[model samples]
Target chain A: MKSNKTNMKYDIIFFAVALIILVFLFLAYFFMTRSNGYICEIKKDNKIYGEYKMDKDHEIDIKENGKLVNAVVIKDHEVYMKEADCPDKLCEKMGKISRVGETIVCLPNKIVITIKGDKGSDSLDSMTK
Target chain B: MGVKSTKNIGITSLFLALALVLSYIETLLPVFIPIPGLKIGLPNLAIIIVLYLYDFKTASLINVMRIFIAGFMFGSAFSIVYSLSGAFLSMIIMTIMKKTKKFSIVTVSSAGGIFHNLGQIIMAAIVMENYYIFTYFPVLFVGGIITGIVIGIIARELLPRLRKIIGFEIKGSE
Candidate 1:
C-alpha cells in the first residue's frame, strides 16, 4: 500500500519528465535541422585534431617554418588549405570543401581544422543572427 | 512467503540502500556548473549492480524510487519535472538492454550512465533557459560512452557475488 501510493506520486513525476524530454528532443531536432553549414577540419600528422563550424568568415594564416603559406575560406561550403611549404603537400590535395564534413590540415606546424555540423555555444552568430 | 522471495527482496533492498549512499556521495562531489543540473553520474554504480544482480523489474522500481526520493531530499525535489524524466529514461534503457545478447552488464550500465546524462541534458534544454549545453553535446556523447564502458566493467565484477546473495545461482553450475 505504501509503495503503491509512493509509486503513484512517482508516476506523475515521471509523466512530467516524459513531457520535458519530448520538448528538448523537439528543440534539438529543430536547432539541428535549422543549421545547414560546413565544418573546417584541421589535421596534424594525418591525425584529426578538432573541427570548427564554417558559418562565419574567419582568417587563418598557416605559417610553416615561420613563413606565411596559405590562408583562405573558399566559400560558405568549401575551404582550402593551399600554398603550404611542406614537402608532403597532402593538405593541399584535400581540395575544396563541398559538404559538411571536410578537412584542411597542416601537419608540419601542428594545426588542423575540420568543418562539422552544429556544435556547442562557442559561436554565437548562429542563434543571435 | 517463501525463503527465496524473501531473500530476493532483501538483496534488492540492500542494493537500494547502496544506491542511496552512492547517490548522496556523488552529490558532495565538486561541480563547476556554469550551467545547471550537469554532473557526473555516480549513483549509477548501484543501479548497474541492481541490473546485474537482480532483474530489470526490480532495478526499474528501485531506480525510480531512488531518484524520486533522492531528488526531493538531497536535490531539488520540487524539480520533479527534471529528475523523474532523466531517471526514467536512464532506467528504461538499462532495463531493456539488461536481457539482450549484446547487452552485457557493462553495456547496460554504460547505457544507463549515458542515458542518465542525456536525459538530464534534454531536461536542461527544456527548462530551455540556456543553449550553451546544446553546444557541448558532442563532447558529452563521447564522454558518456567512455564513462559507460568504465562503469560497466565495475558492475560486471560485482554481479556474481550479488547474484549469489539474492539466492540465484549463476548459470553453468558451481
Candidate 2:
C-alpha cells in the first residue's frame, strides 16, 4: 500500500511535467512560427518550382508531366491550396497561411508550399544563427 | 512449455485482431480535425494493454503485424512507413517506462502517445524534406495527450478484468 501511494505520486509528477513541457513547446512553436511573410515558395519533390508574392492576387496551376496536380492561390496577403488532385486532398483542407514557416503540404504529389519573409529578415535559419 | 507457448501465441493473436479492428474503425470515422496527420490513435489501447499484460517482445510482435496488415488494407504505402516509425518509437519508450516500475499505466501510456506523434512528425519532415511540418507538432502533441489518457484509463480499467480471465501473473506495478 505504501509503494502504491508512492507510485501514484510519481505518476502525478510525471503527468504534470509532461503537460508543462508540451504546453511550453506548443506556445513556443506558435510564437516562433507566427511572423508576417511576403514571399511564397513552392517546391515539388524537394525542388524549387516557383516563388510568388503574397501581395499579388493570382492563381497558379502546378503541373507535372503536362498534368495538373495542384493549384495554388494567393490573395489578400494569404496563400492557400485552391485545389489538389492528391488522393487525400489534405493540402486543400490546410486552410490559408500568411505567416512565415507556415506550410501546406500535398504528400502524394510531393508538393510543399511555404510562406517565407524577405531573405535574412525572418528566415528560420537565421533565427537559429 | 508447448502448451504455455501456444496459449501465449493465441492471446497475442487475439490482441492483434483487436488492434486491426480498431484501426479499421478509426479509418471509417469522419475526419473531425482538418489537420492531415492527427489521429485519436485508438489502436494504441490494444498495444498498451498488451504491453502491460505480456512482455515487450509480444507487444511489439503484435504491433508490427497489425500495422502491416492494417496499413495494406486501409492505407497507402507511405502510411506504413509513418506508422512503423511511430510505433517503433512509442514501443521503445513504453517498454522503458514499464521497466522502471515507478510510473502508473496512464503515465506510461501517455508517454507512448506523445512519442508516437513526435516520431510521425519526424518522418513527415524527412519525407517532405520540409521542416515547416514541425509547425503541426503542437496541435498533435496535445491531441496525443488527450487520446493517450483516455486509452490509458480504459486499459487501467480492463487490465484487472483481463488478468482475472487469463489467470496470468502480472509482474511489477500493480
Candidate 3:
C-alpha cells in the first residue's frame, strides 16, 4: 500500500516561522549595533551640563539637587537618569535605548532626552508613524 | 465515583496544589534576562501535567485558579489585564494541543508560550492605547522558545509518570 498521509503537514510552517524569528532577531540586533553618537549639549538654567560624546557606551554628567549626577546610555544617545538623588532615582533604571520609540524621562529634573531619526522629526511621529 | 473518594480527590488536589505552588514560586524568583516583553512562565508545568493526566477541562480550570488567585495575592491590581491576556491565549494553545494529541510536547509548548506572551502584549497595547507595543514581538518570541523548551522538558518528564498514576487510579483521580 502507498504510504498513508499522517500527522499535520503544517509543522513545516512552524519550523519556517521559527527560522524567520531567528533571522529577525539577528537583524534587530544588527540594526542596533554599537557606534559613536552625536554629542548632545545640555543646558539648564543657562548653566552648562557640559558636552557629552554620545557613543555606544557612555554617560554624561549633570548636577541635580545640588549634586553631580551621571546619565548613561547606549548607542544612538538615548539619555536616561543613571544616577540622581532627587528623593527617587526611578529614572536611573530606565536603561539604554537602541530603538526609535521613546525618551528617557526624568520628571524630577525636568529632563527629557529622546532619540530620533536622521531628520529629527517629532518623537511621537518617529514612534507612532 | 463518589466525590468523597479519597484517591479521586487526593490526586486532583495534589496536581492543583502543584500548580499553585509553582505559580507562587515563579513570582518569588528574581527575573533577569529581559526579552522586552515576556514572562518566563515557569508555572506551566501543572497545566501540562494535568492535560496529560486528568483532563483538558480540569487542567484549564486549574490554570484559571492559578492566575486569578496569584493575581489577587500579589496585590498588583493594575496588572490584572496583562495576566488575563496572557492566560487567555495560553489556554487556547493548551486546548488545541490537548485535542490534537499529535505533536511533540516541545512544539506544542513553544506555541503555547508564544501565544501566552502575545496575549499579554496585546493587553498592554490596549491599556496603553497604542499599537507600537507590537514591536516587542520578536524578543517575546525568542523568549518563548527558550522558556517553552525548559518547561516542556519539565512537563514531558512529569506527565508520563503522572499519567501512569492516573491510568491505574479511580476516575478523575489525576
Query: B1-174, model 2: which lDDT tens digit per residue?
Result: 121665666778889999999999998877766676778788999999888877788788888999999989988887888899999999999999899999888888888888998998899888878888788888888888888888899999999999887774433212
Show model 2 residue runs off by greater than 4 Å: A127-129, B1-4, B168-174
Over the stretch A1-129, how does candidate 3's per-residue lDDT look in tens digits?
222223334445665788787788667544543332354444443344454555555556666675776554444545555676543344565566544443344433544444444445333345455
DockQ agreement of candidate 1 with the native complex: 0.02
- What is the C-alpha lDDT profile of model 3 across B1-174, one tens digit per residue? 323567757766776688778877776765464333456787687777666666666766777777777768752543555777787788778678757756667667778788888887787656544443454566777788778878888887877786676677654444
What tens-digit string does per-residue lDDT give for candidate 1 at B1-174?
221665556666777788788888876776543223345666777877766655667767777778877877776543456666777887888777655444455556656666776786676545533333454454455455566767778777877776565454423223
Model 1, span A25-77: residue lDDT tens: 55664454344445665554445444555666655664547778656554555
In model 1, where do residues sit more than 4 Å from their true spots? A1-129, B1-5, B32-35, B129-132, B168-174
Top candidate (TM-score): 2
Candidate 3 residue B128 C-alpha distance from true site, Å: 1.7
Worst 10 residues of 1 chain A by lDDT: A99-108
TM-score of candidate 1 relative to the true fold: 0.51
Q: In terms of TM-score, how similar is model 3 to the real structure?
A: 0.66
In candidate 3 the C-alpha lDDT for residue B121 amounts to 73
